[model samples]
Target: MLKKEEVKKVVRPEAPQYVKDVVEHPPFRVTTNTTLETLASYLRKFPIDVVPVFKSIFSEDVAGVVYPHTSLLIKSKKLDAKIGDFLNPPIVVKESWKIENVAEILIAESKWGAVVVDEEGKYVGIVTLRGLLSALALKEPKAKSVAAIYTPLGEKKSRAGFVKAIERVSKIFKKLVGGEVDGYVVLSRENGAVGILTIWDFVKSRRWYRGAGEPRPLFGTRVTRGESKHTGVVRVWRIMFRGVAVATPETPVEEVAKYMATTGLYVVPVVDKDQRVIGAVTVWDILHAYLYGPKEGREDIEVRKAIEIVVEKPTLETAIGIRPSKHVTGLRARDVMLTDIPSVNIRDTLSRIRKVFLRSRSSIVAVLDDGGKIVGFITRRDFLTYIAEKSLGYWKRQKGKMLILKEQVAPGETVRILVEEGTAGDIMKTNYPVVAPNTTVEEIAYKMLAAGTDYVVIVGEDNTPIGVVTKDELIKAFKERGRKAKVGELMTPAEIATVNFFASLHSVIKKINAYELDGVVVTEGNDIKGVVSVDDLALRPIEETLRGEKIIFFTKSGVLRKVSTGLRRLRYSKVGTLMAFDVMRPVSLNISINNDVGEIIDKLLENGVLPVFDEQGRLVGVLNKMDIVKDLARVYITYAMPEKVAEVKEMEREIKQS
Candidate 1:
């Protein structure tokens, strides 16, 4: 794996000293001196996706633009029209702001691109929609996910607190980058909105995601390893997930969600005075308890607590289960127990940990050492990231490296690093930080960035593994599943060999094919470090797993607007497969011969339920629609010379004569 230092060089760097240091100058631009005919013809010939709006106001003052299909030089139109007529008010940002903030503006505005402005308000460069999207990756959500949160700063902060923050950040990453975006924890600088704390800060700081748990709300599944005939077998200690900050068995209707939110864990484990694992809490359970039960439509976060404030603590017999299911009227640690939680011993092989988890329908596997004490846990998603990090192969001949003092990278560094390395482990990281099973999400996000890793192993009192929590687990707290549970209640334990980190790209495929598992865990010795997916490794060509083919469209920004507006004209709202959630906004493509056209076409089709892209990323030309017409003839071949407009008009005139 790439050393944390190497990754930092590309991610962080000191401030640039000069005006020209941060911005790229001489960026491609278009001028007002051009004629409509020439502009239209130029758009077709040029490969760059966007054209600079260059009018006489300032050499770099971007004013307006025109699209590929646009024209005004017709028989009835003026030939001297300038492209400035179509320019819209420019959206600009200072080069000093981090790209993370830039992305927020981009997503909110839904514009073609944003302009980079200097302190003096002079234009520097532009970040197109495609450029911004290329800088970041978006993802679809997982099944049964929620986002519980944690604060980066709290009264408990210290060395342990900082590490906890890193662990929480690693967990949040499960939802932010490759995973889906769920609910988020707002880390206020002073706990009173003094300043904003963002995920990027955690990453730039190299902190790990130390949240309560990933994809929280452990509901079911129990597993037992195959019998060993040797000296009999070992029985691991069942983790007691009590006193883990959950609603009281007697917590009232409204207070449950508020308490769940405070913990930033999906399921808050309920416990008795003995601190034994009794009942469980999940977002799904709370939703049902409130929606279909006594509290019909109250969205208040403190209703259950509200009852506690007014009425005194009542007797358990009367307060516990007034309703038929004994779930809604009152709840406690015992009423919602997910009896047989999956767990294992530290001495167990990593492969076995993988099996116990796959066998159990739970989110993680809990592990104990020789004395049957809880050590830590492992989640399926982190297992996958570990696999991907370890499986990464490099071509030493192409190795290059970039040193970022801060979170900034350039194209040159990427090329240099790729040409260098040869082995997979040469690019993987080891000896990262971890978190405790009981740590709250509020405390873990702060330390995540400093560690530079993406996950935290949740261990029980005796250093025995119980479960793994990830960023995705935190986000899932609110989006779809259980929120009344704690991190231990939801985490997946490392049981069967979670898989190896450096297995041949081919070997992993065979394992996935053989076991039919979700993905194989990648590990070092007995410890689970990472995991590999069948989807990324199943292809024949080894490099196919490394990079993806991309496509581009060259057009003026106007066409992009027209097309996107047309597609969204129906304006349907609701979440389902039918909704084209991944539809593209108007995007400009920088077409070049070096890229794969087939891959681009496939990606386009995969995104929008249709195949199409115009010069300006508009639907003026549909892929399927174009194909049918092409089949009707041989192909769409342009004439060597322009068809005579006079002849065409004369043909219409002759029809009237007839």
Candidate 2:
């Protein structure tokens, strides 16, 4: 018979872990030119504590780093400025460095983590405090439960007043030395953990109060203050994240650390079987354990070969010869098509079509014939074009070309009435792209790009619509494949269209129409000031017209008057005068042409388009949703089904021949 300790050791074997085992790809990296607003948007989406900044995409030189807390501290107006203007020098370490040494450096520097580089001095990945904790937890399986490491929320602290209690909790988080904690949980007598709050919530609330047009606060409570008052009290219940995840006291420390590492959530509240709050486990506590806990049997492993860091998990699988399921080569249009279509009769009034667009929340509305067969389609762009033309016509009919009117020339209601009089067929695009239900998703994607559209309608045997495939569906498919292709391989190479910052709105509209572009970059000399898109120019006016708001015009008499006229006042306005700096998303939202396409798919889906730059920071091409869809289709045909390559080529030839 073996002794108990000897038997336990035989049952579970221990292996040494290294920093390379725990390092992961950073969520996203930004260039020094990235703006605070764009950084904030990325932080809001991923909730990562630190963001790495590179000198340029072409090199591995570290510029600096941006913290979420630092981003929140800047005024909203200054968000348009470049991040390089306000950054902390980055702390870098070798990939082979010991985890314990890295932890000491992070604590001593009072930083989140250091950027990891390969022996060749090239960027590889990041090793965070959270990652170290996770490695430690895995190395010590027999370690104590979460209760041993959690910070107890005593009865008195749990029952304290909302604001006062939060202040105290914030102080406790501030005193931690190793890892940073930005999240806190609220406990109530009835509910074990009522809600969770992070530093993000407070910053978001500030933006809302400053009228930056941020989304309403998550907490349903509103803050009211006098004109002279600088502060307002807010109830804790209104601002906390009510659906926060919790861990039981008896849960394994490794389990909690694994959850934090996977989700980027650094804090978890501990509860008892009765659902009463006991304590909380944070990233700092996990770090403390790894730094001071038992290391009796643990050892560090040596890394011989350099490991290639992949930012996406699925990409790593692809690197190892495991193709994702969506790229199985048998997916057809029917497999990924959206069956619930929004449609209207060809003869339906424009008013009816508008209502359908608003209700369905769709960008495209199918136009059907009398027999319920698809004939054409109406897009939001079409409506915008109609309004712009009508407004221009009404302006042209008036005698004054540049005169500021003192009174109403035509009631704003006239444009609205005229717009509603046309039928869907009057503005519907007849050259809409169509596809067969059995067509491969790749082929569908190709047709969309060749036709210069974002979607393709799937037809049945009789040429009637069965379903539709859009860029969104293709994005999902591409995300699953986890291809390692670079953005330069898929982006549409074109000279960037630009307009002077001082140009009039009339010139801006002309440039857009002439180039058939959705937007143009605004520049001063060679520097990019901002971007003005179709949404800013056309959609905004249409929304104002629909809302029955009076258009303000300043007459030569120097008095501002509310006129019920058409869009004549806006036609001659300077772009700089009317354009909102915040509307300039491209100021900081660009990607390197050499970056992996998988890293920017989400950004393309969100912005509809992105500006691609070379190593020299010069705009080389534009990568839009259509470009990605086309590439996905091409990849699918090339790898998944090689036999279809010739067929796709012939289709391309036919499209070009026509």
Candidate 3:
């Protein structure tokens, strides 16, 4: 007879518990044939991120899953698309699956959550990252404690002052680098109350810049400032996100972690008994302190490797060997094609084309002739390539031509390079990929990968352009299933390119153009704080500026008026006096690398980009929609259709010989 302690260790120590034992039963689902509109309604009405799709009303089997963003993307173009048309690869796990094994699969697959099914393949319940984290939080060591893990504000607490410009606070972040804190608790400039300031707050405060030599939007109209007034200044209060989540020195580590996870904030400021801002503790610190203990130094484990270690419970089988029963068929081109295609006219300017891409949140655009026929296609890559190879020379030549004796500037004055502008016709590629509405998903997949293009024009039988099949659309059509790519495979690693929130707006824009990226992850030294997109750069609000200042006085009659200080101040008032913080949406969505390609697509459809992080809560990379389309297209061609490709090549050879 074994003792109770020995029995407990033998039964549950090696392999903790099963996911089914801890899954939440969300009372919302739709059948396989649910209408797109109905699915959209359910998604909007429910708090669930994804609605599970069942095989039938009577069956317990889950056919697939649909998310709000995926539905919205489809309805924006194909209003008739069914829930079945956009179902993600079903991520069903056995009820007996160990929690560690289940978490491994979820992370490896890049899933938002998993649907736990019984031995009979009946849908039992769901387990999301929140649930997983909650479970993991319970396991955190409580003995060695919060004070050992958190960094004390110490002397810096008193340094938190008001009236500091953004430039000054940025210097504080630089000094606090690698000190266990990523943000500071700010003291109000006027009231002496404690506030919070992070690097992301600074990024959100960036003024809108619409390229050089373009008029900025004022009130509602575009206005150009005369040559004399250009004052560039960013004040601190303008950029910092005002509210702060605070913790007391004596609070438990588990309590802080729970708060951080719930709010999706990485750092929390610690306050004294009277609620004075003291120091802070970052997610990076808590993860290191709580998980590995204070003795262990931070290590850069590959996200997958990290998941395998932290979630290293004894498993009966590996995830790759787990074969699912269902197969996806009847997926059509029209079902996933984008009909709300952005088109550029031959007469459209370069600036206009740029705006279209920015507005559509797409990289490629079709250029149409007067007859509404697709003549060419333009991509950011094509324009940038052309600009890189020829624009410099063109500008130099144009400047040489424009500069004569009278037009020549004084010694100290720099000559403005006259860049030669062209119409959309100049840069658009004439050899655009084309496909018909009935084109098989495999055919478009192969062609997209082969051509290295993100889109193909979908035309009618009469050769009239109807819609565009983009990589995003094709990825949605494929329904990331058996042997699909992982989020790690598609994400742009943070180390290769990243932007700090403290980086100037000009610097960030330059990095975007330089890297040809839609956005860059805003980091506080390897820990991702948020992301800044090019689209976020336009139409941001600004309040105070060195260029000019306007005071909005409110009357007792409930009227607000903008009164300028003077013409000199208004004229010299900087272009960006106040910046809009909402442009940089918080980094709310994240998936582990083990998560699937379909999960990445769902997030991409929702946020235009998906942030990838490790199990340790550090942001690793971001997966753009184009990244999903281009990369998955290759994976589909390589693994999904290798045998079919060989057979087709053989048939083509035989026909040629005949």
Candidate 4:
């Protein structure tokens, strides 16, 4: 185990740096009085995403910012209008702000950049994602592994399916737009990381339909007839970009940024030796690293003595082998279901459904029959899909004008018109998944996953809609149950993978990736020294001398062989030189094996893995969210539906065999 003094030696605090050091002059600026045509010309001339709009040139007061995409909302006839009408508020920060603080603000707001202001609120310059990356590339500070910056996908967010799963597109889109993930890492049982889907891919593959009469701006209010049928049946695989660049946990953040810059890829999957994706690195992550160095430190554990206690006592409503009844002992659909669900009559127009969504701020709205029975449903995602299908071309005026004098409108107006004219029954989905009010939360999870939806509707005995359960509710239930369950009940047994203390960094990474282990126990002879997990190894700094170094180690047979650092030399440097003791974190199992899983939930999430120890302080097992979720699901399945036990067992057997 590493001592407190040793742990302090590994901590690297960055020197103070302000945003002014990296700020650059704005490439172009527009005034509020500028014509839309002038703004469009400037946007076309300069390859920039956001343009700062000033209240006046002399005052240098920022009114707002305009994105290149904002043009899609304007009508051709309105091009002469002032640009101020469509301005979005700009994110402004003081020049004295720390780079990391600015990065956090931008990340939180999902903005690409912010306008730098002086103490008096005068515009000084702009700091953008690109500018930060370019500055960091030039500085080339000590490189850190991608693991420190990448976002882990865990079991719930990761997707495994056939490449042609068109129905999964909507779910993936929701995840992307909702900020759940930067991209979807498409996995395969046989092939591992097969492909990746990002927002850029969706933007590039956007197709316009001419059969929808005329295309208008994305936000146009004009009504049109009929809808495009192409988008619904199209396979996502056809649009998914393949053969994307991949990174390993050991890959340096600098290298990942370089790949992203050289290629047009915005998201890169961090895979293991077997090519299975464990996490993803996005442009935003790279910017984060540039601002805040490699992320370090494990969450402190709170020690609690082991005691004999029942984790959960079954009630008559939840007894094993008994049929599930209303309001089970644990969380159920009724407990988390939303009773005030948004809805629209079957005969209501799409315009009405849109109003409900905006007013209620709901993701899904139920389509009800005259008797108040749910016949179908429409989601915000559905509206996005509808817009995508119809906003492909310019809408041409059909009457009161010559062929050359026909008025042109944006796709938004055309799509808006189509939606207003269509009835709820036209676009509402009837195949949505549903569950009974008495259904267990875990069962609802299964249904949502199988149905490729984020929510499940709960109905009463008469088959009338009662409430709705969403991912938010499911997460709340898991957290509550997790707090009551003991670590022993959720942990993976102590038969863990191990590596020698003298092992090369290459070997350590190979072991981790080969077995798909979150980390490995570092051993010196028969005793454990420390643990070297992916997160641990990622925090190790890359030195110039370590690059391309040759490492020689002896095998059990006493034969010594040399290994090159390879192309990713910065990451694969000889661990013997850097010392595994420097990279591995101290292994102190303060978290008791018998303690509630909730005590370590925050730590497990932060470090990605934790070791469990028994009463006598003997290494017993490891605990992670992946194992806990799997166990919880299994337990819930058995308790709620006894008849499915055999089938669930069969599925588990196949999983183990695979």
What ranges in model 2 sit over 4 Å off? 1-330, 345-359, 368-375, 393-421, 497-499, 502-518, 534-538, 542-590, 614-618, 632-658
Across residues 346-414, which tens digit of lDDT does each residue of candidate 1 receive? 655433444564566454555555776555544443343333343322211101121111111231111
**Best TM-score goes to which candidate?**
2
Write down the RMSD of all candidates, one decimal each: 35.8, 26.3, 30.5, 25.8
Q: After superposition, how far is residue 68 of candidate 3 from its true place, in Å?
A: 59
* Worst ten in a row by lDDT for model 3: 552-561
| lDDT tens digits by residue: candidate 3, 1-658 | 9999999867754322667655766556688677765655444333343467888888777787754345433313454666777778767788788665765675456554677778987677776544554444556443244555655555343322222333454345442322223345555432222345543333222231211233446688655565424343334555554334445455556655554433333456665545454556665445545445553332222110000101122211111011221233345578678777678998786656756765676767888899887788887656554443442111111111221011111111112222445678988888767888887665675576456555777888898777878665765665544236677766767753466545544445455544335566766666566665543332111121100111110001111112331111111111111111112445667688888876556666645566778788777777665454444344444455566446656766798999
lDDT of 4 by residue, 432-506 (tens): 788898887777765664464557889889887778876545645666664367888666565545556655444
* TM-score of each model, in listed order: 0.24, 0.37, 0.36, 0.35
Q: Is candidate 1 or candidate 4 better by lDDT?
A: 4
Per-model CA lDDT versus the true structure: 0.32, 0.56, 0.50, 0.54
Candidate 2, 1-658: lDDT as tens digits: 9998888767853322555655667566788888777777666545544667889977667788777666553453465778888778878888887777887787667666777887887877776665665555456543345655666675332211222223443343232211244466676655466655566554444443243343343357554443323333445555554434556655556656654553445657776666666767776556655666423443222211111212222221111122222443457888888888699998886556656765676767888889987788877667656644544321111111111111111100011122224677887888868888888777777567556565788888988777888777887777766366788876655443565555544455555544435566666666776666554442232110101111221111111112431222221111012222222333558689898888888877655556778899987766655555655556554666655556645666798999
Better of 1 and 4 by TM-score: 4
Give the local distance difference test score of model 1. Answer: 0.32
